[model samples]
Target: MLKGILEGCVLKVIFDNETYGYEISQKLQEHGFQGISEGTIYPLLLRMEKNGLIEATYKASVLGPRRKYFTITGKGKGELEDFLTVYKEMERAVHHLFAQRKPEADSEENTGFGEPEWEG
Candidate 1:
């Protein structure tokens, strides 16, 4: 469900910049995806690395232990592009479906659930 979408989102974030786990989670929250924990992010990062979509390097952190920073590989970039294409098609399809629905005014008129019409 959400995990599937989050994988693509994680890829996009890594594609945008090389970052560590906590920072990646923070970026997800900043982009309106709240409640995503570092625990979740780490597993996804590991999976991506295993899949060869991203590469990681150990870097010293000023605050604490060495951080494993992720950078998108060439394969990752290609996958991201594919995801973008699919996402855009889904977006357009959803928009078209919603557009075909009757407007609120029409709904109210037919359903008799809105304010009463007054005769002059």
Candidate 2:
């Protein structure tokens, strides 16, 4: 589950802008995903490229090293859309599960620990 979520996040980051491995890891960390290593990201990137969700090209970097910049494919955009749809539904369900409900005001029975008391 977390892997899929991370993959979606990676796709989203690439969708926003083309970036290389280290930059992508930094962005993920900056966005509150701490402890994500380059090792993890690189493999995922390779997998996504192989799966046709993304395409990578070598570009000259200012730091004097050739960087593999990743861009989302048309298929990736479609996958991202599908992820958004599923994510929204999951978000709604989680919100609904945690949402507080107002208690009955006119009940005469004692409510124990915030639970409605059963009349025997």
Candidate 3:
């Protein structure tokens, strides 16, 4: 489940800018996705590459070895669009569910299902 979400996020990151795996992890962390390590991102990148969602090119790195930079393919762009559509729908449903539940929970507390209301 989370992997699917991460896949969409990684594709978006790549689509926005062609970058390497480590840099992708850093960007995600900067965007509030903490604890996303390169270890996790590498396999996802490999899978996206194999699935034809993204393509990689090797570029010389000033640091040391060549780095593999990723770019989104046509298919990847389409997938990202689909993912955003579904994600937005789910997000709305989740918000609606919680909004509806909050009133119910408050009413239950006032009704004294468990702890009694203070009233003092």
Q: Which candidate is the best by TM-score?
A: 3
lDDT (C-alpha, whole model) for all candidates:
0.86, 0.87, 0.90
- The TM-score, computed over Cα atoms with residue i paired to residue i, of candidate 1 is 0.81
lDDT of 1 by residue, 36-109 (tens): 98998888888899999999999999989999899999999998998888888888997787556455546654
lDDT by residue for model 3 (29-74), tens: 9999989999989999999999999999999999799999999999
Q: Against the true structure, whose lDDT is highest?
A: 3
Tell me how candidate 2 scores on lDDT. Answer: 0.87
Q: Cα RMSD for candidate 3?
A: 5.2
Error of 2 at 35 (Å): 0.8
The lowest-lDDT stretch of 10 consecutive residues in candidate 2 is 105-114
TM-score of 2: 0.79
TM-score of 3: 0.85
Task: List the RMSD of every prediction in angstroms.
Answer: 6.3, 5.9, 5.2
> What TM-score does each of the candidates earn?
0.81, 0.79, 0.85
Q: Model 3, poorest ten-residue lDDT window?
A: 108-117
lDDT of 3: 0.90
